[model samples]
Target: MTTFDDREKAFENMFAHDQEMQFRIQARRNRLLGEWAAAKMGLTPEETDAYAKAVVQADFEEAGDEDVIRKLMGDMTQAGIDIDEAGVRAALDEQQVIARRMFIEAQ
Candidate 1:
């Protein structure tokens, strides 16, 4: 193949890898966020695990983070937690950093 074709393939591969990593990081962040919320709600260990998985699944309902945020906000509110959207959003941001670091260390 020509040099241009090789470069194009390299870029495509990089894009795919980046997309996959972003998905992974976001999933991890969601799990962490769920665990955080679960603790706040005083869930049992088993319940926390299930709730974390549910939070990860919540991401699939929409294109952005709003779905997961809404699920968390609703669940927390129902459980009588006094947290607000800003707090959840802040936790989401913090968990994202931790998730990214975890992935990098795993590599």
Candidate 2:
């Protein structure tokens, strides 16, 4: 006894729930990245705060996820931080896996 309207409503509810889950997962990833970056920088408390802000700002301003990771890797290298491409790629891959999981869950 399902009508067209009922089906549409169900789809809309599912879509909204998926979107929420994706956002939550992304937020978690960002927080983790900020902590990792701060530790890598070996910053003092004050410097860590500034570094975390810069990380989040860069995340916002980057063109996309890949671009954000590339920028971070490049900056780290330029800073003489001794980070390799493999490490950067691995971090990005981990985050991508989380994102993909969220996408699948949404579906």
Which numbered prediction scores highest in TM-score against the true structure? 1
C-alpha root-mean-square deviation, each candidate: 0.8, 4.5
Total clashes in model 2, counting residue pairs 3 or more apart in sequence or in different chains: 0
The ten-residue window of minimal lDDT in model 2 covers 26-35
Residue pairs with backbone overlap in model 2:
none
List candidate 1 segments past 4 Å from native.
none
Off by over 4 Å in 2: 62-64, 94-107
lDDT by residue (tens digit), candidate 2, 1-92: 56988999999999999888766666556545655666776768787676656655666664556655766687677767888778876776
Q: Write the per-residue lDDT of candidate 1 for residues 2-85, one digit (tens) a residue.
A: 999999999999999999999999999999999999999999999999999999999999899999999999999999999999
Compared with the true structure, all predictions reach lDDT values of 0.97, 0.68
What total of clashing residue pairs does each candidate reach? 0, 0
